[model samples]
Target: MRGLLILAVAVIPAVAQNPVVHLTNATHPASREFQVGDRFEILITGAANQSISVRTTMRGRTDWGPIIGWTNTSGRWSTSGQFEKGDFGDWSEVWTVGGKVANPALHFSVGAPCLKGGQGFAASTGVNLVISCETADGRQTFGTASDSEPFRTPDGRVVRGRVRSNMTADQYHAEILQYLITSRASDVRSGRHGDEAGDLIMKMIGPNALNEDETRNVLSIIRAAFERPEPIPQTARDPSRTLLLLRNLADSADRESVKQQIVETVAYVLAR
Candidate 1:
């Protein structure tokens, strides 16, 4: 009997299409000027069953630079990597593929990095996006893209440029406190203080006990507002509401000095 001839067929899987990556400032799609808090988006298509990685670098510099303040907002896409501090003390984020998801869209907010003196970006820093993907066929593809226009922090002039590298920690802390105070004051003047105002105040104080100088500065601002007469536009000055919030914080304060200062400020407001 003739030996039976058997033929084996090898089936090959289809290769995945190369992914397209797009990075844009969703908050201001047409403009390159980004404020302290603005949203940035990364859209990835044709990435089914492929692994992807996203990295960032400054436009001209090869070394990684700070990623502004990157806070992820989208739940659709997930990442295993996190913001890593570089050797130069700058920060950058690497988003590694967590799972195989199709057409992932990522959204994040970019705020000014906390500088030595709470200063903003000194120059118009252009952050470039780099993406790499491994296809199902084991082929690697890489792409580098950036925003349509270079990002410029127009408010840098208002907040002042970046702090000097030689600034002391104490000076940095003081600058942060001053910035917070000035911001809150602006909110009050613009009638932007809302019900969540107290939450913001507490965030400014943080969990640690404030130093004597910090405590004094906070009280001084409260006193100045408390003593001011009702403005022509009543909405312009809501000292009572602000004081009520501070009073609540005072009641929960852990430090005697902080509590005392807040209480004294509240009392002054109540007395008026």
Candidate 2:
């Protein structure tokens, strides 16, 4: 995966002037190549009781965006950001506290050399950076439509891009069902019986993808997977933590009925 994680340090000193912030420990990958989808974390510090905010902007672009507030901990704060090849370009990050701008913005680039065949990143063109789908011949599709397209139905249909209009109810349910089952199976096979499967399910279902019946069925499947007595090779499975996954999903449910059903099911399992 081509990506960069920059760790920055922001210092608010006793002197009133010249508040400086810069990346201290920049760990370059052995390849020194960074691409979209890679994340960077910055460690920031502010004056006691000072409020902090961070924002990033593409270089030479008029708009500065994704402004976010920092969570302070004893005059120190740490925040992270990710690169999405969609908006591939030179980028800069600025920090502010108590309405004072921190001098010198952090800068980086997201584009080709990171991708196969040296294709430049384009926002309109979806880019897949996390998972590599290289062919057995070591051939990679770069700059092609298939290069960045991530999710696809088993039938070779792309799942994104006005996808709802194209999918039938049965198709949607089938896709989600396959996703949930596959996620659980993968986690189990990898010796993980924790929240990984649960997290994937929540991400896939999102807001209102599944109806009540679908939700119940999905939860039951997950419950059965968790209940399986597969020995985790690396670490012993924690049943309480496993149960917490269901509880967390229940808490995130928007519908009262769905929430209640998940909660009750979790409780019943706990009783068992």
Candidate 3:
């Protein structure tokens, strides 16, 4: 009864593995910082053949707490758009690629979204540029990279950069005051005093004069004024108005020295 028995064996084929893709390099500003009107490039590299999507975000506190760049407390600006494609806010851009490619380079320029306005006076340690990439189908992530660099407005750059380790407190104060005066003069000559008060607030709160706590408090006042839904009044924007405010604060014995410096700075600017 050893009948003829047949044995059948089933074989399964091995599934192909997906190629490893990742960001090899990403280029940015040489200084790792951004200023309005500045142009820079970001280059990302990886293996080719797969479609990928790239997204960039500005990572940091989103509150109106003192930052070096713009703020939207007044709602005059839109913060919910793509920055690469020209929108505002911390979330920057989302770009896609469909064809085979080994490298992708992105170009950008700092604009109004990086300017406009701000609240509070906390010195921005800086913001981070967070980048992420993923499969077009969103199934697999390529990887992520971040640049913990600060984004500064033109004014911010000027004020912060002017601080020299070799400078005495008085020297620092005088130089910054002179800068404010020159800036105000330029505005006066150009007949555009736009945001002069705002500019003053920025310079006065520089690292030279106030302690961190004082700077933050003063900035809070400035922030409250701008948080109004209505546009800031021109009178409020007046440099003289800011001077008056500074003078009033100078009357406080504790803030006398710093406030006097700011008052002198504003006076010099107005005199110019």
Candidate 4:
């Protein structure tokens, strides 16, 4: 199958300064800028000169949620973030990283509340730069802070997260789904994309992919994408469209259990 992820990195616009962050690799020419969805590496040139924050801020949790914080240890520093599905069918995370570093600081941000996940990093002088992501909700972190691991549904038609660090916005995910559905709905409609998205899914999902793995990643991405700063108001018009999309993926992939779960979720959301 074909996947858009294989496409080369696209160009990005310049990030504003101050409270705004510029996440980039030192190798790129300064003349060019990264767009909100252009993927780039964060390189620390000076000890205290480097800091990155999420363009969006997440609320601190009273008992749970992404309470992300990090400390600098010896010259070695590491920061890790994990997100999992909650009892109420929400994605929540608890993030912490500690290490000594020249700068001794890590910047983290979120698009919504701690409900989805956390984003941050640490810098140590020379220690290994360890960035770990895990989920108790049974989802797999794709090995970076970028996106969820890729996998296929039981039917053999591959599917995975359409969102990544570069496109760290709900609108991005929504647009991507809309594009895929609009393009394929005629043949597959709310179903699966044959080659394009499939090929991209292979690269991300990899060989170790499992059925549960794919389910967790897909739902987490969608829920995270649709999540609001506050709990989705139980309103009739609050993005009830996703119910069909989510259920379609599940049914098309033959995930009966997940499809039923989504149907119930749709009822709850619509009832609100």
Candidate 5:
């Protein structure tokens, strides 16, 4: 089995209103785990009339400190941030907003553990973050209502958790696709069968002569997935299925079609 990081998530209120503030991976939803060092984006939408205030605090389950995103005054804005998990555990990102916010979106990155100072995050699995929103004044004065929602940090918990029967079909699909694209060569050579699948899948995807920037920007995302720790549980899904897909992908008769499918599927999996 491949190693995975686990993080703790903050509990969300059951009867909270609909969230006006939202957070997402720069390329995918929060259900997916991002490699350490990878960057994620933040977006804020909605209509804020008066002076608004927003504060987001994130803490990992382990003792590694917290990743915080905040705004003292609010308006309309779009920005990006990244997280660094010193040690592995469940990490959570909490967002609190006061004032008028129409529909704010947040985009950010997840750094890779192998990155500089990533040893802390790599020591274990990962951390978790939860997102929530509310009126700073606890009233409708901000032009928005109090709303809260829980989001699983893109850490491997979702992927591995699927085996224990917690993930949806879409979540599982995203996990598998992420594994295929990001598993690295070192991990493959580390006597791991899953990494072997990733190695084979990358070859099957085969950049196919893409230009410099195009290849780097496009393939980089896929490759980054391979570099992160495996989030899949041994019992969650059949490894054979993944290997079979990779092998079938190499078959010339259906190569182009499979390639297109992979591209489309990956794109959909990472879309905002």
Candidate 6:
């Protein structure tokens, strides 16, 4: 039966020496209470690597069906593996991401083969386990793991909860967004003697001080950022506050274009 796909996992923490994440299941197929159509939810924590794997075994040949369904952000992640009802019916799949540098995510999963199996022709609905991990250099990531316990598709419905689900979509969005912005600026961390250099970059298009070339570079960066599918009309009145604070670091011969670009870009973004 397709309901045979129920799986639960838990990762235990390591003791002494190097840090490690333990993974196992408390209630597995061995549980007498387990049912074919029974769905559960599980969660894992602190997973790294921008990529995580998941799988399940099929019961038999005639009992299996084709593993099918498409991911929403599929093509962007450089992911691997495939969905198939294997020879014995072990349907497995994996998702690789665009590294933590991209602020990758998993919004929702619909029409998975497993859902149709156990529940007959009906679809199994729930919030798929979403995890984010870090790069080798420690870049922030998202969607790298899943529930450490058994969470049926129904048990793991979307639209998060409080307490265990206190963190809402808005909060998660802010977290991922900040992680991305920080990653982009990490290379320039040392350039800032104080906060002045940062400020100057923020007001890149501003008049007085920054030469034409400097403004142009800053404008290019700003324009490029706007080109992305970013949320229009950002709430950040002055994202360059950090840039302004770093303005003092501007070099003696720094081109003026950069400064003008900074101001102009800020105006353009705020205007939208």
Segments of candidate 2 deviating more than 4 angstroms? 1-19, 23-33, 64-67, 71-73, 113-272
| Model 4 clash tally, residue pairs | 20
Q: How close is candidate 5 to the true structure, as a TM-score?
A: 0.24
> Total backbone clashes of model 2?
3
lDDT (10s digit) by residue, model 3, range 100-217: 1112222333322222243212222244232222322332211111323333321112112232457775455434433333233222221113234345544443312233234334
Cα lDDT, model 5, residue 175: 40
Pairs of colliding residues, candidate 1: none
RMSD of each: 20.4, 16.1, 24.8, 22.1, 18.9, 19.4
Better of 2 and 4 by TM-score: 2
lDDT of 1 by residue, 1-272 (tens): 01111111123322334333344555678964333233444444333333333333222211112222211222122211111111111222223232212222333333332423332222322443322233333333222223222322211111123345766654454344445443444322212222223333444333322333445555665555444465323553446556655755554355687778787777776675
Write one digit per residue (lDDT tens) for candidate 2, span 1-272. 12333323345433433334544322343433345445445555545445554444332221222224442434455544454444344445556554445656666555432434543333333323322334333433333233223322111122343245677654454445544443444222322343334444544433322334445665766565456545432333444544655665564355798888787767655543
TM-score of 6: 0.19
For candidate 6, the 10 contiguous residues with the lowest summed lDDT are 57-66
Q: Which stretches of candidate 1 lie over 4 Å from their true place?
A: 1-80, 84-216, 230-232, 236-238
- Name the best candidate (by TM-score): 2
Indicate which candidate wins on lDDT. Answer: 2
Residue runs of model 3 more than 4 Å from their true location after superposition: 1-59, 65-238, 248-255
Give stretches of model 6 more than 4 Å off: 1-16, 29-119, 122-176, 179-272
Instruction: Give per-residue CA lDDT, model 6, range 1-272, as digits (tens).
Output: 12222222223431212112122222343432321222323222222322322222111101111122211222211111121111111222122111111111112222122322232222222532222223233432222123322221211112122233576554443333323332444232222222223343433212212223333434444444444334423433344554442243243224465445455655654453
Model 4: residue 148 alpha-carbon error in angstroms: 19
Candidate 5, superposed: residue stretches over 4 Å from native: 1-19, 27-31, 50-75, 85-89, 99-272
Minimum summed lDDT over a 10-residue window in model 3 is located at 74-83
Model 4 C-alpha lDDT per residue in residues 96-133, reported as the tens digit of each score: 11111122222332111121364533333342222323
User: Lowest lDDT 10-mer window, candidate 2?
Assistant: 58-67
* Angstrom error at residue 250, model 5: 62
Best-to-worst order by TM-score is: 2, 1, 5, 4, 3, 6
